[model samples]
Target: MASQQTVFMNHGQGETSYARNSSIQNADQERMKPMIEAAIAELCTANNGLSRGNIVIADLGCSSGPNALTLVSFAVEAIHKHYLELQQPPPELCVLLNDLPDNDFNTVVKNLTTLRRSDEPVVVTGVTPGSFYERLFTAESLHLACSSNSLHWLSKAPEDLTRNQIPAYDIDEHARRERLPLVVEAYANQFKKDFTLFLKLRAKESVPGGKIVVSLLGRRSEGISSKFPRLVEILLQILSVTASEGVFEKKKLNSFYVPVYEPSDEELREIIQEEGSFWINEMCVHGLTSGMDSALITPNRLANQMRAVFEPLVAQHLGDVMDEFVRTAEQRWSLEGSLQDEVARLATVAVSLTKA
Candidate 1:
């Protein structure tokens, strides 16, 4: 309902910075590699637009940090790899890194110098800053556009949720997920409207036969959220404690809304069909289920991970309680049972589309 409200990952570097806490995104991109490669191969063979001498590919929601350019590198390498398989020279690459205007573009730009590559490919880059739901590029100016782990963030929280018309968070010091039936309907409708508008705008910007690959966190079942432990509920639980301690106003906790919605694969397909701008090439709802097993899971690490994502948004309402909040979160998450369930399952929806 609201338009163009910004949500951002923690921009700079630190334990709580998105750059450090974003390892899971690397896994998401790795799972998406096959879909990306296939799309590039099809773009090379099926579309004659590759002859234009320069290929323009956009990595939407390219948040800053080490993983920022990972997708961009994937597109570039995939195109060149396809050309190499055919023993042909790949065209020049024009890379666009897109994110919210508030995103840490500086970190991404700084990391560009460290990438290993040769000059034969001649990669030129630019930064596109704006909401992807709006027209961020010229008409028919792109060959491929991809987004990862970002679409779940709506253009804004539902106006009803923000205004406390829908009872997502309660007057008491707790999040009301059981009372989320109306909350689910409101969020679903908002995501449908935003995602449909996204398709239409990209259709106007992309070539007639361009490709779009998108992967974001989604529900496995046909519901608003996953059956597994919800990390959001954990965050709300901590926030409510802060409110009860008189750190923030009770009404603030009641009114603050998370501007994100994880749609099911069915809901995604429905929106794509109804929009009618792109043909679904490949679609799936399976991703890393093993979750964060890389290292010993610690409460500090887990809280920092969630804090990197939520600090900016949470700070808007809670003010200077962020450090104290993170401290409190760490204290709560220190128990053995706190995070083993939350980090056990990570599901994502990946779709490859061709402009019709």
Candidate 2:
């Protein structure tokens, strides 16, 4: 098994730029609201009532800030909508915002405090810092578990591969290609472990027939072939140019590959079945077009949004190399006419699961 340290290094921290963007909050609410509402409605109907007991919801990998609260509000509204139809007293609601210990807990608290003004009582609890791969909640306690754009990250690093292999080299195509598989393998193994743990934990924590909604970035299987996708290839090329200009260490360029695997609908269904304890109710793949609502629907805008989420992290790790990489990427995108289209197309998948 890869050590948890590696996973932390690659995936644990939140992107500072993303954390600061109100646009992301707006986009997330718009994207997830209807889906979450529908899932809660189904869960309530299946269980026969919304007033049976306290309703508990957990947002796993919830970064600190208003975004988590936005999710909570959506869940609360869904519950209330169901309650209104039944003419029942609103159920006591418990919202748990969970993330890594290093996350901005203060931000989460500040956001939750603002959300407490609703007429319906909402008990907000912050899970004292922890990894979702391990135990984070008591068994049979959570009614719904929601994780968006978070599960693709591995829970730990691929130590075994790293121990056996030499340091990855960008110029060595064969070595780079070989190392990618190992990295992917390690990420897959950790994803399996975390996902399996998630199902098992939810089984114990969730009431019978409770539901979980997960929305994540995913790619088609064809995207992961021996040759890198155009998007990834472009990123590498930019990194190479930046490195030559002495903006970043040559080795830092090697770390630019996307870490999370984007499973196809079929692949995800298979994994859900194999992992057990949950049944997939709905799955849909859609383009991530919401981020472009106000911006010119060009590829540069799309790339900029991607950079908004990545540049800060790279800067933190690679410093001057980060600036050069961004500049080079922008130049390449401009030259390639990458943003010719009015809309930037990205693939995303959302799935609803129920306790088995």
Candidate 3:
């Protein structure tokens, strides 16, 4: 597996920048508000009468954008509401916004200071730049940790996938679907390893009885025919067209891989149990429809949304051809049939766990 070094969100302000195209992710984060509240409440209650003076919370893979600060705001407000319900003074908050080193931490903090609610407890936000697969905090320092739409990212691409010049989710290109079981297994096993290490690290950093909430894009189906993977197929076709043109080397696409895997519900449960650091308190899969409305699914918007996420990775490999590739994707999407009458459902798995 190739270790990921710069898997951060798109930066700056533009139509394709993460700031503008992250509505889907923001909606997903909003969907996690209740889960965050519940987790914080559990953390507060588990402390009994202990003062808990300073509450430590980490938002792992906290990308830089509006949605990132929105997550912090939700957590702060959740903790405030919990303290209010308990008729206790709110504890000082120590929030660690974590992501890859390439993330725009300055923008994250600036946005945090802007979006922070005045009524929320005093929060001292810090930037933790590193991979979540590694330990970032001291032992027993954290009270609650939450991640949204992030855990699906693997620490590295599967070695076999890279070796075979197969992108992680490109199961439909070049007769790759015929090798579905092997490819999916490789991705799943990689996720299991990364997620297991994640659990173990968080377990050590978290105080006994601490809480963690994680929400990730995943699949209910065991096969590669899911909507997300199918979407990647469309993207692959678009890339293939770009490759057909002399714009870039065709072999580059073969070598490029996105270090991400969307696991199934059963796979997640199995890994959590195998990790054995935390007990699952609540686990559920939620469906998300793009902001194009349940009745309207425009591919242009969807493609741009996907592009915003993947442009950084693609640019790293494709370099100057990145713009042409994105344009080709947009054109391909614009020619697609109207899906307005269809309701496209995407799965997101939310799990809340407590330290054992």
Clashes of each: 0, 7, 0
lDDT (0-100) at residue 269 of candidate 3? 90
Number of the predicted model whose lDDT against the real structure is largest:
1
lDDT of 2 by residue, 77-195 (tens): 78877888899876687788887776667656766766454576555555546777777777677778888777765564344554554332355677777676665566566556667
Give the alpha-carbon lDDT of every model.
0.78, 0.62, 0.75
Order the numbered candidates by TM-score, best leading.
1, 3, 2
Per-residue error (Å), model 3, residue 149: 1.4
lDDT of 1 by residue, 15-76 (tens): 67899987777778877888888888888887547667778899899999988888878888
lDDT of 3 by residue, 1-356 (tens): 25543687778767778887777777778888888888877777776223558888888988877877766677788878777888888888888889988887877878766634476467787789898999899998888888988999888888877777665544246565566677677877888899999999999998888888888987665543642343345556677788888787776666667677777778789999988999998887766553325433455566677788878887787776657766776666554453332224356788989888
lDDT of 2 at 283: 80
* Cα displacement (Å) at residue 353, model 2: 0.3
Give per-model CA RMSD: 2.9, 4.2, 3.1
True-vs-predicted CA distance for residue 292, candidate 2, Å: 4.5
Query: Which has the greatest TM-score?
Result: 1
By TM-score, the better pick of 1 and 3 is 1
